[model samples]
Target: MIRGVLEMGAAGFLPKTASPEIMMGALRIVLSGGVYVPAQAIASGSEMVLDRLTERQRAVLRLALKGMPNKLIGRELGLSEGTVKSHLSAAFRTMDVRNRTEALYAIAKSGARI
Candidate 1:
């Protein structure tokens, strides 16, 4: 649910059980152009960073995660190598990762289901 809300571009989410102080903090963060994702959502594995990716980016990432090289990933996806690289760059940025290893670690840490 949290992932879905975030995927829809919501700046933050607060459960009904949130205390007023927590809600106020979340609101303040959102108002200041920040995104607030509660630790509970992350702990529960509902804060998938991949939720920010487009379908093509996810497809590219899926193959890349399989240890496929860029050329092969592009060939399999019917995209040019440059296109594949572009998608990966965008995906890395969206996931706030610096490289494939970091992206993989982040994905694993988030417990996102591919």
Candidate 2:
């Protein structure tokens, strides 16, 4: 459901169990043009999860985070576009996200250096 809401373009999601301060913080983040995800939804120890990414996957995500299209990322990395896509797909899975936007939110929430 959280993924569905995010996929539908919702700016944030707060579980009903969230405290008032947390709800307020989420609202502030959304108002500031950021996506808000509950910590549990992003998973604990996300840095370790990030570490599981292959170096190629990390390279792809670094380029993707820069807003590069897959084709451009491929050209820069000397990979085929299909290979770029594959790397991104694997990265998303490692990050437990369904797409690039969710991946970005998860990365931010995790406080990982990337």
Candidate 3:
């Protein structure tokens, strides 16, 4: 896991703990051919082996990435907004993340690429 972190650092994979603002800032630097690591993340570990998400979680996440709100996602999935929130919470836990942005980042960084 540590090795994966090191390699990710070398290859530029930001951890899921990064705030959306920080992530966007880091992304700008990366896009300019520079690698940016958050100072607080220096001691953070790698995201190794994310178990495959359930079909429901994946469905919710797919819409979430498309910028859908939980209410809309629930409506589309024929689930309650509360149920969508629960699935999102479980997805965040399974992805080792805190927010939707971080989960999306982790998914991308982990090579799932949405």
lDDT (C-alpha) at residue 2 in model 2: 72
Model 1, span 54-86: residue lDDT tens: 999999987775456788889999999999999
lDDT of 2 at 94: 77
The clash tally of candidate 3 reads: 0
Pick out the ten consecutive residues of candidate 3 with the lowest summed lDDT. Answer: 40-49
In candidate 3, which residue ranges exceed 4 Å CA deviation? 1-50
The best candidate in terms of TM-score: 2
| Alpha-carbon TM-score of each model against the true structure | 0.59, 0.61, 0.55
Candidate topping lDDT: 2
For model 2, what is the C-alpha lDDT against the true structure? 0.77
**Candidate 2 vs. true structure, TM-score:** 0.61
Candidate number with the higher lDDT (2 or 3):
2
- How many clashing pairs per prediction, in order? 0, 0, 0
User: Each candidate: what lDDT?
Assistant: 0.73, 0.77, 0.65
Q: What is the C-alpha RMSD of each candidate to the true structure, in Å?
A: 12.9, 7.8, 10.5
| lDDT for 101 (candidate 1) | 52
